[model samples]
Target: MKNIQFFFLVLNVLIITSCKGSGIPIDTETDINIEISTGSTVNIKIWNFRIDKDTTLLNFPKTLLGTYHFIKNKVNDFTAFNSKGEKLNIKTIGNKFVIYGSGDLNSITYNVNCSDKTSINLVSSGVIVDKDLIVLNNNILFGDFIGENRNYKVEIKKGTNFNNISNQQVYHKNDSIDIIRFRDYKQMINSPIIYSRISTNDTFFIGSTKFVLSVHSPNSMVKASLLSTILKPVTSAIINKIGFVFKDNYNLTFIYDEGLNEKVYQKIALEHPNSSVYHFFSTPSFINKRDSINYYQDLQQMVAHELFHVFTPINFRDNFDDCFYNDTLKMSPHLWLYEGFVEYYSLKILLDAGIIDKDYFFSKLAEKIYNYSKYVKMGYKISLAEASENIYDKSNLNIFYDRAAVLCFLMDIEVAELSQGKYSLYSVIKQIYKQNNKFNKDSLFFKMNSIAPGIDNFANKYIISDKYPDLSFYLSKAGLSYTMIHKEFGYYFPIKIIAYNSKTQTITIEFQENISPFVKNKQIEITEINNYKVSSYSFSFLYRRYYNQEIAFEIKYIEKGVLQSATIKPILVNVPKIPYYPNIFINRNMNFSQKRIYEKLFEK
Candidate 1:
């Protein structure tokens, strides 16, 4: 899972950075040059400062690799050099710098600054390269400074041969490493990092954009193959659906981690228009691993969610400032449009492709509804737009996704009804992308109004206002109805089955929350439910289908080095089923117009 706390910290830093001048230009000549020969160090040269100043501050990042590591210990032997290659004087007052030299500082080199001597290390908002691979970032070579007409050139003295992110061969005319130049701090965007590996490679194009997607999953060939198969088509779908193109090579690196769910880092270059790079850290199960395929069920959805972000906040840049601190704690109110809509499409696309059935889609929707209902029941009423602005501050931040998705569900239904089955939310978004590729939130209502007359009004009520929406009305229009019931919903199993072995049809009990004192946390195996052997594939279906039934849990385990068997008759308990979302098969009957809307919803 993503470390939410760390994400918040990084968000705070970005908010501070945005408060400063973003677009100011410092006219300096000659492109910046970077030379990396070892994993533990980087050499950077600032070509020229166009303006003359008494003291220039070269800001070194205090944090390392987002918020996970600190640079205080990671960076050391920080030295500066002049145009004559002489060591210039420098002093670290605090985390920032107070430099005394004003000459043409040709270059500066520092240790890579990582405690972990792994082959691949993350540092300074980017990845570090070593003997195994070479992943580079601009932070190591360049600080946040105003430099005009400044391009960059990176030369790998040794290690692995590499290709540009665009899958184009890195042309070295006497080792050609061309760095595209841009003005302003925000425009630089952690300028694309270059990497190379010694292994043989292949190139694949995602739509018109060239991609050099490399996988370093040594443990799981299944995962590497899955990535190879899914990435291209998924990329194509996002590109075609959103109507965006890449200007330069988009580099992607997929590495295997033991227990890490896939986390993505998408870097878009303002200098190199439409150019971006992505790094995915995925946890792949080993061969013969049970539940391995089951884990991959939502993998495509995960990938789709991140890829959609490329079109929204990354490509369709957020108009508002990303401040989540006190006083100025604000963000783009269209987060619902970004996270919620992206999440909705993540599953919607899967359903459209026939990868999952309508039943599965409804189940996913129900899950989101159930989650959002918790907030509603607590009387935490906030408009979607307000929730978006204070996203990081809220304890129940996920409502940005859950509640927003529910609103989108209603909005899509509304649009279809308005167009008489001619237009849906999908079509509306495509239109918006065509008009404003990088959308401005302030102008969203204006652009959306051009597509449909009442869209702005819908936004006013559902997004901009604090009025809790009448979800039942939307459901009634969609041939469905649901009652928020308070009932006994929990069926006691005594054991929480965390990991399932698909091959053996056995579930290892991770913990036991016992209703009686008969059970405790131990190494136990649950092989059957209601006297029937259950496979990992059928676990979810059976559990939900027989949720209310009094079932027997067949168990087997080792106790004091002896195999044992027991049947656990779990005590049933009642749980709150507040703010229930209507399922796909509505209990309420549908009228002719509602029926037409329902049919159109699943139309391919």
Candidate 2:
């Protein structure tokens, strides 16, 4: 997900005896009622919200990704009136419209309908309407917010046809409607409404926090229960590592793309405090599409990343840009903390859970270092602090993700060593979560330093200065090593096998060139991968589910009718002919200090 695409709303929630949202007012509540009607396709027939304050203008959802067509495609029949039931005239501005006369505008109403000429977007979200399902960004649909900081008392009038509406935070008022209260406008807008003729639901819990998984897909194989089976254990491990920041119910909306709309990029998941929505493309629509070793691994990583977001700026935030969050032009310099830290924790927690191995972890770390080098070579030589500020300038969003991961991975190690292994990055995160403090841009790092000293210096180098240090030194803290292979890169086996001969009960695979010192032949993967027998998995599953990572396997061959397995702990090496990043690996021999640090990799 693009950090820029996170032109998200921040409803600074206040907690008693806590430091969060100290200066922000969140007590005010707006009363809203929505009635949605649909036929061949989903449509918001008529919706009205009551904003008590006198207001002359209305705004559609706005975020930093640029102008959204919410006003043009999802809104119409807009009208406003006071308590007297008098009609009010409104004039269109640029992306917003103005109420002709200023009064205590108690009521505003609108309906969603795409003009015959306007194009609709389903793949990349905000607002989408499909034949079997309808997913609408509530903020994009319910346009007016009296105050950006106010909470909401929302009532969605659902007819009998709304039986398939997303099942989270629902308080049914009868057979026709459901009532729910949001802590802030941010929660209401970011929490989308999903309805599908073909849908399924699964609910899970970690601690007191409840989560409901709702799926809307044409593919019968894409079921909420199936995904829950894949996601629950990993999620439990993550939340177990870093306790759930909030004790509330959340909905995870997973929408599968059946090529019903134009394909955009890949999977897109937007995170919120209480809910998150995902758009799946290239994901296995059918569970049997991938080998047992990697069933939904791609989706697993993506969900883990999005899930970790709850701990970042959501609970731990720099409230400098509050009201400007949606369709915002303002950018925060804390993208490193917002995304970088989350990415680090996501991957680490996944590793802790065995959802991913150390080989994958080390590969990702090296890849980030390589990515940082590429950007530096391209004249994008700036610290994450600067890049985050100018994220839209040189399009350094990707750089932040790469550089930030590199920075945090190293920082986690450095932090561990600095405190004599007392506090890792997650330690700093948990302390921040407990304090419930909102950081200021200038003092964010200093505040982190107070939590775990030396953070400010780390920030000065990787975030505040244009200095990318020797990553090898940091990896060494935990008995790890890094290096690069200069070779050509090729396709990885999605099935992790090429051809299988059931008659012989044997498997065969091919490689363009041998890049690793461990594996010598061009086509020699004769036996096992990650300890799983190669013959057990399907030889041919079509879509690409896994990406650029070294595989750990063994080259087992039959010699004189005796099964012989090579000693090489293997990773397929299809290195690009061009220069690449360092590869991280576990060092078998380590000093006492290195062993202590390495043992703490999963300390908490």
Candidate 3:
């Protein structure tokens, strides 16, 4: 089973606009020359700087691959020179450099010594250089400066025999060098580059939207074709559910780490306009062991979350500044919409595609509520909008983003029920985007209300109000009952069966909570039940063989990497052992109105 615990560091992009200075030749294109050496040192040179009336602060990112890996001062020799070769005095503030005292800006040069900083084998978004490969993102390579109408180009001496790959437009200038060009600065920085000696890469199409998976891993079974096969349905689900597809090809660069770093723990998946980079924890060695996508359910969900950004706040944000984070502290107030809507759909698409059952779906939503109360217990109180604006200073709102995701889930069903299945939150969003893609963040709820009718009140109560929501109160509207069941008797099962593999004759099981106190939570195979040898009976018979038994029984499973037999004894306790998510289910008897709404909730 893939680890559900992973971090998604969101480093957004912005297009900065500055007024052009008088008589200055506004550069039509910005050219950068980069040099990469075999041992150390990654050098970058900015060719020209067309000054603007306002300040043009050149900045570099301090963090990237992971939380703690600092890429500070990787470019130590930063210096600017005018056309007359005169040195310009510059004042530094944090990571940004204020460019001042310059005639016609001639060139800026800097050599990067990446080995000097604090990566310490962490899988960060920053640059990584080693014997085998060099991974780079524009956040570390280039400086953020003025933009608009200025084309971007990069000339680099990439090295011999190293397979060069990127999401941007790449053209070869022989075996030793390559060039990449973008329409603007935003496009250029959004593209990531990977140079490796050997890799497994392939291309597949989902409804004419080409996807290329370029993988660099030491594991033999981590094939691009196999990954493409595993992720195809996930890709298709997002495309079909949203009713939109990318017209151009998109890149999925998959890179792996074998060192003693925490790369496997990072769970890194950074999104760009035309591509994304997925840094998997561990060796990515599960494909040969189990090829089913259900085995990697969290991966499936996380991939969907990243892909949904293409539609939400990413493409739909009003202006340039709204889309990009000009600084670390400045964040959009509509982050709740971005994270909540995207996360809920990640689960919805899977359920819609039958990849997961409703039991698992409701359980996940319940888990979110259970987790949020922990924060509430600690005296944390803030509305969704307030939490977003104060994300950095106060508690991180994204950490408890489920508070918002639950809101989106409620909004989704309300919209569906209100429209009598004529519309949903997803459809209304797309509909709004169809009319206008540039809706500002401040007016997001306004558009949602205009299209859905009742969302204005819904937003007022759940989003703007800091009152802790009674999820059961909302679930009741759809003919659903939410209850917290205490410890009873007799049903102490060790595994949660999510899916059955008929071909392999194995049941995909998840250990959610309290079943296995000693073992870690994961989906492992139940190879044998009692003495029946699970493969002998149908999927349903596992119940009679285990659930109804009052006596002791023996079951075999992989215990500490070995198949071992263990005896299971039933326990009946009046006291609850640990906190668990409340149970949610549809009521058998409901009023006609609620029954109709529930039917629309699960409408085919």
Candidate 4:
């Protein structure tokens, strides 16, 4: 499954009053002094917390990795008492905390038991610890504001030995604090624990675009060097093609885990327009080391996919809800624009950079068309617009990627044809970005038709309905075509074999589910196929030649010390080939319209 990071506004709020018998003030506002110190590798200590009100409610993330300890005043003090002579009662439910503040509590504190499970992430989220490098954001450290929103001053003390810490507030909100600490302050030599940071950060620029690139892994210096060399040139190409300029700086963090032998990159975008964080999780198997060209190609594709979001659906959509917290995977109606079209441009930027050719682009589109045909035939008849909303069923969600890609491909061709090569999907996208229009079905429908006549009708037929329209006309517009024909694809053997003698040229069979009335199940000398001698080692070629089709077979075997033969003719099965066509390739020659469409598809 493809893992992409997305941010949404959490809309959970509850109104409740605390049960009060303690002499705590109700309407009076009081200062809450919260202090956090991580001077040792043992654990994090949050102390000296003073709350003024009796009933306090705050948001707490459920994904917090460690256990919490409620203490009074100091690090060693485990008693839960306040200064006002009233006991404190605290309860945690999901992402909210209801704290019963009393007069007896002088000060309160909590300790987080850190372990290996706390990995650092870019998003300003729950408690994350990388080695001894701790990141405490907003509510995770000193709980957020409660009741009426009011700005509070927080004093954070860091160990003298710590390095690379940031506590800058990006916004003026009371809960906008973000703190990150790097490296261990006190290393425990005698302790059996990981107590250091493998992550490092530096500034990188692509032309005027600034990026704070951070790599968190051992030997990440080499990866940083590789990315720094080409970051500028690649961004220049992508910015030009996407028709959007980055007005704000961003952060890119690459995390390489050797244990995870797969290539997975996720982008965690914040609510701020100036900041975007990407987490590139990869391993040796995913990063190509055979040469620099292949490595840069893979890296560039991944980077462009994330940067292009600055225009589409990100700036185009108004709001999105937290689906996970709601216990449902409700998606934005423009998810196709979010993922499918974003992916289309991700690959298109590669071609724009000259990293890929036109032929390669067509081949990719054709592959998607072929892959999407299966869902259409399976009666998964939800319109792309409907599927975009209720995509909780992951089984058919991936089809959205291909279906939208091919849809964009066809739409571009149609617009070019309708407008006499004057407008295309690129034109519509550029207009949206220029106007900063929020992407939606109605917006796109009107915007496309206004760009060129008949474009809206084309979208209605292809995008709003569950029908899979014929793409032969569009394929021909690009000077490409595919014919469906039944051919010997492959075969699967139902019988199980114990062993085969390659040197002696003998086969030993142990099990058979429904062996044909041909050869016996035992050690047999296989010598011929269709009366032809099998000494030339043409088994692979012969299998393909007889795949999906039945043919006469002859096997030479020694039964009871005598040579025997049997002829068995099986049934031939031919399957549908609609899902296998469109193998998109360049035509031998192009007409005027075909040449126009191709130029429009790749033009800047």
Candidate 5:
């Protein structure tokens, strides 16, 4: 009876083996198949080889992104199993694991125990595989990680329904999961997919290259339309004037955060024009339903700034060494060319487009100048070139942007003067663009020397060398001057107040501190600045101007219910100032002759 039972068991095993598909054997030559599930589990299938002679291991990378300097190897929670479903012995080798095969094994399988329920957070850039390494080259502003000659394949898991992804093949299995595939690393790095519930439409262009907007936020359509309309003309102008022949295509993407308000979006859009892609987050604090006009205007400015990158350093980089790299942090030294020139054009494009009047443009320039003065006073001023080289240091990032713009303004004036009212920085850039080659620090230096041999020394001393130039001297050459104004004895009061509403039409005293006897029982109202009746609603505007300055104010204070008047002077407060062209319209008119000269040099 026992022999009969054994025979039956062997016969059943043979039948089960026949029913299975072509299975992988151990201790034979074959390829390995790894199946990674979204649930954080991995299945390994071996073919034609025996499991007894093969080993499997799972591991993690040693470094994270951005920091770039730190390196460490640590991995855990790994296990292996055999065809019989028996657990195998495992040993750790740094971040990897070593598994012992039963005998001449041809197949193996292992599982990686991850704590996260989703696989999104596990995705990373800058991967190192054994002797192979992958790095994204950042020298060309719009360049991608994959080179033109290389080709590879990537397959994303399905069922996670991430939508509106461009330049990628996506497969959907359900609402929560999807799979994406890329032909190579270049495609993956150059194209960044933003997944959000908010939906919006956008317009994009680089010469004949047109992009339709794909956003998740529904409320962003209007703003996206505005951006599309504004950028169309500007991009057309750039392409018409300068043909696109380089490998880098200036590809960029804009991602709007439905939670971000108009003001914050405007700030980000204006500031980060050259970013490969901008993700604008809309939070409760940034957007409000009541201020649609302001919101629209802010969106226009954001679009203008972002689109401007196509013409500036993005297309006309300073040189190869100045380019960005993953391993090192450095700044580009051609701030006068990059930011300053870009700022000048951003304003010019808006003016030429008739989006803003001449007066508004000049007012903005004045604001910049006032802001520049604060940085100058702080003894932290540097030339545009120096600022560019040190820009990514984080310790001085903020100062570089504003300061570089100021230097560009000065250089524009210098170019205008040198060419006898005939040439400007615009002409110089156009010349470089016509050359149709990548820029490097050495090439830029050589070009500057070629244009104005003596100017190189001047640049070395005032712009390139490690010293702050006397900005006042340069402004004087352009018939401008910087003066410090003081007001300390006009009238005295101990209260700080502001109007509660525009309807009030009158300033209201809000707080009093260390009250003086002369104004203790007095009701005071601000009526004028330098004899102009101060609009109560415009008090905030005035405050912005007087951020670090003391000024004389004509006040109407009520002493015991009786109206009184006094002129009070407050101490000057120190604040940072950005350089501005106080008379941009006049400057443009005066410099119009230079445009003709530039036309002569490059127009033909």
Candidate 6:
């Protein structure tokens, strides 16, 4: 979910009065007015508010205390009208609006409209009246404004049903809907509500928190069910280990196309059974085909990846402020700890859960190894820290997820080898959680580094440093080998090729490799290499470094007609041999111990 910002404004006026009970003259009487506006086409719901004012003067909030920015003034398009139907020009100075003189303000009203049409972004609209007075039931989503646990009376213009409303305890009386309570403001913001006719709805009871799944389409039902199922076991595992659970009460909503297929949802369900998934399919001619197996696999992988978030980083962490959502300053150094470590566990969990077979798991691991090899080959290799900091950006998203996954695989194997199969990446994460009071990035790294002595150096060399580390050595340690192949072709020219430099009158014959017997006596002239046009003279210069086998060129010389031409086939040569990892299991080693581990992890 994206971060959102909220704004608040306060108007103040001063008046003098005599205190009857406490004697003496006291500046007691003060009048203040407040208004909030929303510029959204979608109905805006503000279920929490906090405001306090006294007789002496109106004291407004200087800032949304826990929020990172100053947004009081940006809550614009407001007007203060008097009882006589006259407009009152108001100027905002800092947090308070100066209302000239002291007078009893009768009432306050506001009209909040949606200003932007670029899809409903929650934070850009929706303002909780008297935000400071509102008690935060959960964590803050975007800015610092928290939701109050108290009931709120919401009056919407007639004829519009509330769509994507969070915390389902809202009741309708007369023309107003009374919002009863909220689980957490922060969680509410993370779960955005989009209004559409078709949606996937699922309900689950997790202790006191009622988990609701609302998606945009019926096809999302399978995915939602799968997410719910996966999370249930993981959640049960955590509960069994510890006496508590995180994210106690929450709604997991997903918005996607309206016409998505059921098979897509089923694949997602197969992948993630613990998460509440939702989607809206927008197309009608949705077809199921065999080629879609890869697509299903990818979707299931994504579901498992997301559902794992519930326990791994969400519940256990080092620093809260340095979180990716709130503290941008501290996020860079901890990206690897959060994304990389989490990625490692996601794959492990899938393997352990028995969703994938042992051979398939190793094959996936091999693919990671291969991809990491390519990333190393590239000049600009990124460390976990660099990848984390730039992960959200389009340029780094792929590397962050892929490279981190590969590193996790290597590190998992390293841990497994070091502990002689007693400890794995799971142990490392569990240890991190146990050591840190709060689940955060910094603490996780600290714990991980403590267990693995050279972890920092490993991170620096392979992750942070520009120098590429040879992965072949590490991979070979796990009983793997690397290979590279090269091939060459021979050409023969009968006639001596001449290069006439029109600018500098030079003559040269391009170098032709070992001559073939058939064309030895025929006059041949090289005109191009790999489709790149070159003069007969420049062919010698172009042939030296052009090692690729897939080379194409045209040979032009007088034959049957004026300018006869023949196309040359590109030479086919083998490059480096990457490990062939199978995606499915047909023939692979599977023993009792491996089967036991897989069953214990997945419980399937």
Residue-level lDDT of model 3, residues 1-604, one tens digit each, is: 0111221111112222244544333343444555544535666666555554334567665543112233455666788877788867677776667777543666677766654213333233456554445566666677666343445556555556667644755677777566666666556556667766667788878787888878777545367787787777888887677666786688877776542233224356766666777775434323221223334676778778877777775677654342232345445666666778788877887888887788878877777766666766776667777776655553564543577887787887788777776777888888888898887767877888887888788888777877666767767877886666643433444445776553454455675444433243676666666654443222333342222335455666665578777765443333453334377777888877677766765544
Better by lDDT, candidate 6 or 2: 2
- Model 6 residue 70 CA deviation (Å) reads 16
> What's the CA error at residue 217 for candidate 5, in Å?
3.3
Q: lDDT per residue, candidate 2, 1-604, as tens digits?
A: 1011111111111111211345533343333434323322223322233333345556665441211222333566677675577867778654476775444454556655521201233422344443455455655655553344445555554444444444347676776555666665555565666666677889998778787898876646578898899889877876677676465677788876533222245456677666667766433423232354455676787788878877776667776533332333546788887788887779888888888877777777787777776776786667778777666554666765787887888888888887777788878767866776676678767767997787788778878898877767888888887777654653343223455554353566554344343233445435443343333222333223234543434446554567766543223334453344478778889888887777777433
- Model 4, 4-62: lDDT tens digits are 12211111111112324454423322322332333221233222334446766644332
RMSD of 3: 9.3
Model 2 poorest ten-residue lDDT run:
1-10
Error of 2 at 48 (Å): 8.5
Each prediction's whole-model lDDT (CA): 0.53, 0.59, 0.62, 0.49, 0.43, 0.40
Task: Indicate the worst ten consecutive residues by lDDT in candidate 6.
Answer: 130-139
lDDT of model number 1: 0.53
Error of 5 at 270 (Å): 11
Stretches of candidate 2 above 4 Å error? 1-55, 64-93, 104-125, 144-161, 164-167, 171-184, 260-263, 282-292, 321-329, 486-582, 602-604
Ranking by lDDT: 3, 2, 1, 4, 5, 6
Over 4 Å off, model 3: 1-41, 47-75, 83-85, 113-124, 259-266, 284-295, 318-329, 484-582
The best candidate by lDDT is: 3
Against the hidden reference, what TM-scores do the models get?
0.66, 0.71, 0.74, 0.60, 0.54, 0.53
Off by over 4 Å in 5: 1-150, 157-162, 165-187, 202-207, 218-223, 230-254, 258-276, 283-298, 318-331, 381-384, 452-454, 466-604
TM-score of 1: 0.66
CA shift at 601, candidate 4, in angstroms?
1.2
